[model samples]
Target: MSRLALAIPLLLLALSAHAEIVIGLVANRGVEETRLDWQPIADDLGQLLNQPARVVAVKNEAELLASFQRGEIDVLRGSSKVALSAVEGGKGEIFARLALTGRQTQYRSLLLVRRDGPASLDTLLAHRQQYRYASGNPDSTAGYLIPQYHAFVRNNVLPERFFRSVTVGNAEDNFRALVERRVDVAVSNTDDLPKLAEKYPRDYQQLRVLWQSPPFSYDPLVIRRELPAATRSRIASFFLDYGRNGPDATRAKEKLYWADQLDGFLPATNRQLREVTDLQLYDALFRLALMPELDTSQRQSREKLLYRRYDQLTALLGGAR
Candidate 1:
């Protein structure tokens, strides 16, 4: 064969070898912040797979879903809500769970009030209607979903119906609202509290935990189902083995911190996300029950549906601990 013919095949091989893989990062912060946080992980994955990998920060679940639908993202790291949504939408499959540094694989949602404001949880719950509240985005697990389910559906006290007002934002925004006295209570997660304290000790000191939800599992790392089986295996193995063993184990742990405060990734399956799926189902049913447009009959039907699902999920989740 001529040299030119050989070069043509070599060029094709090089092109195939460097195919770009886009990993969608859940935007807990601004796009730039998310990019900076996850870049190390992206680089590490690229090195491990010998492929060009990049990170894409999605502002919310909607944006993440859109990206998946457009086939723009090949990997995802996000809350269980986002991961389950992707799987249900036929976009991805849960392959591993992200464990936070010092937190392991479980965390909880917290309700916070100024230390001087509410002396006790009873005091806060007693006059709940008189105070404003700040919660995380609607899609947030610890910040919104878990708290809402615990405070509203489980307790039969809906903030929307009883609180003075309810504002939705990110963890930092909600915590800032609490510290600034913009809202009387703020919903955040166990992991975020320490970070907030570390960054704003004075403000964090002003806040006290009023209540906390039961421990919830860490978010899962999802891979696009469309990828080749071998490629998927490589991706799964990379995360599962990261920070666990090898000469670069220490460096891998450090890199995880740079990639969104993670300690490491643990091997996980879709079955491991069962509880989160149950939570999501319960949240949706509760929301349906609150639909103002529903008539008496419709509302009753929704209530019945909600109760049925609540029982089913509760049972599946091992009777809610």
Candidate 2:
């Protein structure tokens, strides 16, 4: 009996070890939104690997970067913007870029307000003193970071000085705040709109889009660099072979909204990642140049920082030789 007991405990431990994997989700929006939308993908991963997958939704860019650096997560799924930054920092690599139906770029942001509330972006800009503004995460592409950088920073509006409030949260929370009359302006994504509208008809009915940004690039499924190459290959193959299991696989495909997502996972190199990374760096530099907060002295300091980064980037891209 004692021998049997020892064997049983060992077996249980083996099973437990095999069943656990920690994943980091980009918490660009709210934790609830990330969990709710990506649960199916997580579940699918678990079933494929015969393991239980745990997802940690990280807030803000710094948190995501830190978690990735510490190897706390096995995979990261985020927009091209976030993925690019992570890649630049050497924390991960793109295993696959997502697509849906005929769409390649899921990056989009719409400036919105309550349907009965706002007339236009121009009118809102003119009376910017009258309303509150909610942003998604400061690092979020379609959410806060990009839109704000484009609007107030590029246009020299200075959000805090002009708007009543500039709050940050998930896209859902931003929209909800608008619906609840807590904020007068919020930014959201086009990819998420149909899904959100279907989920909350009343809220959708009350909102109106003031403007939409041009499409940029799609999100990427990033793989941790520490994982063994064979293991990485196996996981990539598993994800790419989604429909081979008949009905369950088909159902899984629809649930995760990968009907038209890439044909399969592809081997990605650091160079591929550099494409998006460079874009974000330039975008940040542009914002810094246009920032309203910087004085002449501050501008010179900012210019120094920008030029230093530009030089480093050029060297990294093999341009400084």
Candidate 3:
């Protein structure tokens, strides 16, 4: 090979070395907040991996999945639903999950109101139309999915018709809406409650938890399945070992526990998203339950078919790795 040919190979190798590895961060709260919270971790991962790492903050779960579909993201740390979608799409796999003080495998959705607004869940549901409601995006698990079924559907009160008005936004927006009394009722979850407290201490203090949902799994760390095995191993090890050892180990551990209220990460699999799948099923059930036009026989037929599909999926997921 001539000198030019050899140089060309070397140049290509150098260019590839600097190619950015995009880590998709779902901005459920908003892009700026997501970037602010996750950028440092992305920087550390880049330096450790000897590759250019960039955080591609996407607006919501839909955009995150779209980006992954377009091959614009190499790694992702977001909701379990998105993680499961990636795996189902055959492009990704879960390697780790957040490990907090307790309930590492689960988190809960919450219904909140001003301390004096509703003394109890019964009061709120009894006088449902007297108040405005702030709900999380339709895509939100805690804000919309869980509570929509548990609090609204189960009670036979549709928020859309029951509330005087409804506003859709992120957890923070809904929290602020409640604190400002912009909305009489708001939905939130364990994942965002602590951060909300940090931002609005006195305001947070004025609120009361009206209802809480059953626990579900935390989000997972997912990477493109096509990534080199060595690269995948390094990324998983990085999360699992974070703050566990290093000269700055103590400080790192403290920040992990204090700032994020997370001890570290635990190894996780894509199958852990079973409950989220179940939630989606719950959403389907919500739609079916609300179809008042359907005759009793038709509704019963649909319910049976739906439950059959649900059983098959539960069995399928239970059999997955």
Candidate 4:
């Protein structure tokens, strides 16, 4: 072969060998914080699979979906809502679910208000136009979706119509709003409550849970469905067996648990996410009812349809309360 021909093939081989396996982490924290938490897992996967692995911090669920569509992310870890959305969009499949230490595979969203505040679910409902509310991003499962469904479809109290104002932000922003008495109510999850309490004991001490949503499954670790079979198998094996065996098991367990607050990972299949999928549907209907462009009659129709769908999904999941 000619020297140019030989060089061309060799360069291609080197490029292929160095191709990075990008794992997308849903950003619940700052990019630096998320990268620090997930880098160990990426590094471990690189060693196990003998492939270059890196973690990409996705700013939000929308960005995560967009990245998946662009084929920028090979693996994903985030809320079950995000996972189900990716699967429904034909972009990804569930490969594993995190098992938190001393925590179930499920968690619940809590509606909170200051213990001494004049805000309670009842007071807010009574004084409809007087109370402000804060919630997480629209894509958040525990933060926005579940809480919206619980309030509107389940209780027939539309926040947009009832509350004085509604603001959407991340957990920290929402909690801070509530703590500073800027918002009358906020939504947070059980998993995050402990951390908040630990971080801000005084603010947390003044907070009280006004309501709790039905349990939701822990987020799933997903991989793009278009990835090679060998790559999928290798990634799955790493998650499934991580911290469970080998001489370095203890160190691996500590690293994963301390960094990500997960005990380990368990094998998961798409079928196991039916409830989450249903929740996503419920979230969509709830959001539709909140559209300001919708006429009163149109909004009512959407609310009625949402209530019916909620009942149907709850029946399938053995009730939401």
Tens-place lDDT per residue, model 2, 1-321, is 999999999998677558566667665446766666666666777876777877777666557657777887778766555665676677777776555544344457788888777687778888867889988776666675567656555566767778978888776777788889999898887766666687789889999888777665556678887776865776777665654455676676566563223333334444444444444555667667667888989988877877787666555544532
Per TM-score, what order, best first?
3, 1, 4, 2
- Reference-based TM-score, model 4: 0.83
* Per-residue lDDT of candidate 3, residues 31-55 (tens digit): 7767666666667778888987877
Candidate 3 Cα deviation (angstroms), residue 298: 7.7
The TM-scores of all predictions, comma-separated, are 0.84, 0.77, 0.85, 0.83
Question: Cα lDDT of all candidates, in order?
Answer: 0.79, 0.68, 0.78, 0.77
Clashing pairs in 2: none
Q: For model 4, how does the per-residue alpha-carbon lDDT over 226-287 read when each residue is reduced to its tens digit?
A: 87787789889988888888887888888787566778888887766676656566666656
Least accurate stretch of 10 residues (summed lDDT) in model 2?
258-267
Candidate 1 differs from the real structure by a C-alpha RMSD in angstroms, to one decimal, of 4.3
Highest lDDT among the candidates is held by which one? Answer: 1
How close to the true structure is residue 305 of candidate 2, measured as C-alpha lDDT? 79
Quote the positional error of residue 319 for candidate 3 in Å.
2.5
Task: Evaluate residue 139 in candidate 2 and report its C-alpha lDDT on the 0 to 100 scale.
Answer: 61
Give the runs in model 3 whose Cα sits over 4 Å from its true position. Answer: 1-17, 28-30, 101-105, 254-259, 292-321
lDDT for model 2: 0.68
Candidate 4 has its poorest 10 consecutive residues by lDDT at 312-321
